[model samples]
Target: MGWHYTPYGLPYIVSGLVALPVAVAIWKRRSMPGALPLSIFMFAMVEWSLGNALEMFRTDLAGKTFWASVEWIGTVIIPVAWLAVAIQFSGRDEWLSRRNVALLLVVPATILVLMWTNDLHGLMRHNVRLDTSGPFSVITKDYGPAFWAYVVYAYTLLFIGSTMMMRSLFGRSRLYSGQAVMFAIGVVVPWVSNALYISGNSPVPRLDITPIAFTVSGLATSIGLLRYRLMDIVPIAWATVAGGMRSGVIVVDSQDRVVDVNPAAARITGWSAALAVGQPVVEMLRPWPAAADACREHEIAANGKGARQSEVVQEVAGGDRSGDRSYEFRFSPLLTARGRVVGRLVVIDDITERKRVRDQLVTQQRALAAMEERERLARDLHDSLGQVLGFLNVQAQAAREQLSRGKTSLADGYLETIVTVAQDAYEEVRENIRTMKGVLPADWRFAPTLERLARRFERSYGIQTDLAIPDEIRDGVLGRAAEVQVLRIIQEAMTNARRHGGARHIQVSFAVAAEGVEVVVKDDGSGFEIKGLGGGNGRVREQDGVRADAGFGLGIMRERAEQVGGRLEVRSAPGMGTQVRVRVPLRESEEKAQGRDAHEDSGR
Candidate 1:
């Protein structure tokens, strides 16, 4: 059998016929975010299929070569268009800057130039002739490195472009995944058929079946446009989400390639947004090995371990930031409605200031507490000893008057009174010192401390004292503040009985009642006039620096009790007796805290 030239057949005519409207439809929606690139792809397919059909029908070498050059226009650009589609579909249109697009054009333009000037350098084809061995007339040539170079470049685009498209499909929403699935099918059909042809392993070896394959691709793309409305999702994502974010956000497919990274994400991670796109997550995070590891682990858990609902928290320390900084990252699975894990969404928040503020708050609280302690000490000194010292000066002056009146026995008794008051005041100061050292906040322990005060009064003044404080009072029933108030009140009452009222016996007791804890101190002694020294109200005079405010002790006691939501009563009369009573109330919650503290102290 003899070989002959073949003309346009049923397949070639049909492929060209099918591609025209599909190209127009795709072009019509070019204003969509990703559709511009898609339109370019469909248009290239129209040129390649139509020109290939015409070239195959031409029965002469000159006619076939001229049509082959026209076919090469789409052939040279189809891969570029496919790459652009991948870029746009993945929400990375930022990568296609004018400079990068021009650089992409450079190689393909050179290839087209070489094909046009093939007779001059024969770089594209070393020798050319009309092949009569196949059913269709086609140009046959001994191909050069330039021809192989074009082959290498096209396949490179195909492989990388397909990789990006597949990643786009993997972790997308249901509607998006369906549209991407169709786009993937559109992409795969031509490559598979072309690969078979280039390797001479196609089902029809000499027949160029790529155009027929492209026809199928165009149909699939058309179906995606009509069925899923792929174009609408892009503007929605761009306008509302991707552009407005302040926190660093990154999206990655199961392949771990960065499918999308916002400006904030790129800046925070120290990568250019355009350069970072299509890069492996590991490579982008190389400066942070721990973060990189976490990124890989989270993706694995999300996609493989079925932890689609789980999130991974990673703390990243230090970066290209101006000062010391920390960022908290939260990585979660991007899952479809069916619960299939598709991608990972990583969010980064700067937490350096938050940590610093927390530390500052703790320091301020400690300093404020110290300042309050010092203020409490100052107030304690003024209330207790200041009043006692002034009273002693008054008693010493009275004793001198008695001696001038030639009553030596009365003067000796007055001298003894002054000594007892001074000794009690000294002991009170020592107790305050111990309280300041460790007891804290105000040292109001009523049990042994108050009982000791009563006993000391007995020894100093030779005034037999009666003391009865319950076990609960000794176990710190009152807060330090409350304890100090009640104890000081008792000390003042005892001193006044011996020094002013001339009492021989003083009794102190604690009784619990429905009102609260009640402390009563009574004395059988000479009672002073209550009218001048706060008969009921705690009003005291402050003047003369020596005998000023003789009733200041009574005033302080009353004020202290009232401050802690407690009450104080004073009863005294000239040459009769004196009795002091106080009631203090406390919250149940404070009582529980006291118990807990006591238990902890006991353990120590």
Candidate 2:
């Protein structure tokens, strides 16, 4: 059992030692997808290298044969471990089921048993002897039937694993290319080395250089682990992430050809990946033409000179057996490392539930806004027309009382007052009806509408109404809602002047300011104290020397101003005329729009 140190066997020893740390490093990252199996593969390489090295260093034939048998342990494990690494690395981990693993181990396990029992049956190897040919002694033997059977099984697995590794070279990401190249070299070098040794074409006679070949394989794997970050950034198979995702992912090349389609995409477009790939994307996505057109247009733009297209997102509606479904397709360009446009990545997200929720919320908001408008109308009627009607009823009662007392002149005066009150009430009713129809004209001609309103006011109330609207602020300046609100505020001001302040002359003017449009309604009427009006709500108490009903109108006008991102101000004294100035911004704020929408939702 003596052993001699052989420089020829030193390379195998160095390979085994070098592989030890690599195997340990991979084992430490065993939590990663392919790390555990890869670590096992490295460990098998270490055993096979070291065991062969020890066999070559042994002097006795029995010692050499014993070490050769020991080498079979790693030899038997390498193929299955390599296949497992390939499967896990390619993201086909589901194929490594317990049943499938046991089945894969069956042949390797049989070969191991036969190898250990080879002395009894000689099915693994025979005619084993130590040959001191060339620089060192090496074990030589004629591989028997069982050994050749294991060769066929091991080669089959290695071939499959090599094919999987090669397929990763053509993946979408450039990051995986380097890792795949390293893996290919690692798998192929050892495979070719073994074939050369088996064919007796080894450079050293009777010397198997397969273990030394593993040194090259180990070096390739080490480079991949260090430089390419092999196990850290795994190259997942298409089925792993893209196929399992709920969103549909479609990859189209620059020529508008469908390069890849995930399972979710297949289900969405009603075309399998096999049928979709290599076909024209426009034709493949004919059912979703909007998505196809988006991809095609982006590709066309990308291919054009000086065209830098951005990502596009569009929502499309498609009907299924259940009902209509909404899908949002996002098109993004796939650029290579050199900044060249290679393809487009289309991601389709099913947004049916989001759309349904949004529509329902919108309907609810509309219903709430209608109800709020009705309530506002009811309040207006109670404040203006109802009071007029009550006064008319009182005057009629007085007229009847005077007639019953035989006071003809007094009754006649009361009758005339009633007629005047009834006429005013009729005008107020018509005005309310017009206001309820909305203040903005069908054509949205702001200036003419304001002029018409001023003229109508002058005719109806016998007041001299002057309008000084700027020629620049004629049309298309304000949004429709802002126009409606502005007109309503002006109308409210004029009505209050005639009904409450007994104004004989009213002037409405508009001025363009740096911020926005400024509207001023000045009236020569008996103005009340500005302090008489309450805060924003304009709810004046009886002690405030302002009619509570008048305060309601002021509050509404202020609210209208605020709705258009504006402010309302009142300036007045006991002897001076009152001035209502409102400044509305030209541009709407997002916060203001959201607040208005929320207010409508809450029916406020």
Candidate 3:
């Protein structure tokens, strides 16, 4: 059985056949990612086939010279091919320099030259008897020292290359470590067989199982490549796109089983996350019955093996895990490589906030339209109706003078009274129109606009009204809304004092506070029952902490307070003064003013 390479031939043949399919697959793939290893595996399988076939007919080769040429060529090419494969497979091509190729060629060329020259140099070969114990007398030649020398060079090249390959492959943790181990075994086993034969311990035949095993290694690595789609598989890429989408996704099979659910899908569905593997997507998603119709239509389109979509916005009812949430949904059909319909993929997004804002804006638009209509009516009444009433009051006073004599003058006084009543009626009409005109810019920044108001109150009303307000308000914290509220509060207090309390003194003060700005209006007036007062004329009155008023004046002030996250306080008692105080949170500059006040108070 010694020197019989027959059994080893089977592995080479099997591995070679396997490699054919794998190479075809790789070629079809179109990207030769690592060209050298793949090419080496391919060529090595072919080289092994040729070498094994030649070794099987070694003895008969001499009788047929052409056959002998083939054997000789196989022997020579096997070493070179093995070397090339090992160099490439182990990634030692960088070291396979031009100098190394030239050096390698020298010995083979020398062996050829010596064979042509009749072995005179005596290094290339020396023959030995092949069989001593057989009657057939097949005189097989033994290998010469040069042949052993070639063996050493071949083995050294392979060993070094394989070792480097192992180191490199093992360094990569993510790659096929098992394939690397198999290749190492493939390399080592045949070397052990060769060693045993060289040591004369076993008479068994030594054919290089390494090439067969190397082919097996190639097949294993290729299978790993195909299965894992190690670089990038099309299906995996598409699956990733489906999984990583921003909108909620749900896929259901024909049997209505859930197949997949993405991250966004989890948030919108409002159900304790259902695995998409085997649940009805409609049942799990809680889609309306109408959605099935849209899905059916889309599925019918998909029967043609083309993409189809159904864009539907549906407000799904709340599930057990989530409260209320709105969603915009889209359903599409999944497709396969051969353009076959797979299943439905449902895409959805949570649009609750968008709907909420849209509703608010619609309400605001309606309110704005009503306000514009009211403003137009107020302007009409002020320009037309108020002027006519003023002219009527003037004409009544003139007629009262003409209707007078000495005793008739008493009747004229009554006519004068009628004139006065007419004037009062006209003024009240004007006042109503003014109030209906809404809060004005002058009233809003009353600090700057109050000069004439103060003068008029002092001259005509005969009440000393003092105004102490800064010309340039530093902190714009006292915005127009806040300022209007403060001004109205002061005006109301002043009016109450003049008409009911007969107040002769008034003072208005505006000052920066530690936490906010403060406005105070105090008047020396006969204060009425604070509790007895209704939210008088729909104006603000305090009960507990909240104000009781439906009038726009107090409502505006309260709204301004709430807007700035501030507060208002009113203190009044009968037969004493009344104080109305407003506190508006200071911005940075006013806060600095507050800090200075605190420092001054501390120093004092």
lDDT of 2 by residue, 33-79 (tens): 56677788889889999998998788989998888889988988878
Best-to-worst lDDT order: 2, 1, 3
TM-scores for every predicted model: 0.41, 0.51, 0.32
TM-score (C-alpha, index-matched) for candidate 1: 0.41
Candidate achieving the largest lDDT: 2
lDDT of 3 by residue, 90-145 (tens): 32345466797677667666655554443465454456334434322233555566
Worst 10 residues of 1 by lDDT: 540-549
Model 2 segments more than 4 A misplaced: 171-177, 230-395, 406-604
In candidate 2, the residue pairs with backbone N, CA or C atoms under 3 Å apart (3 or more residues apart, or in different chains) clash, namely: none
Best by TM-score: 2
Ranking by TM-score: 2, 1, 3
Candidate 1: C-alpha RMSD after superposition: 17.6
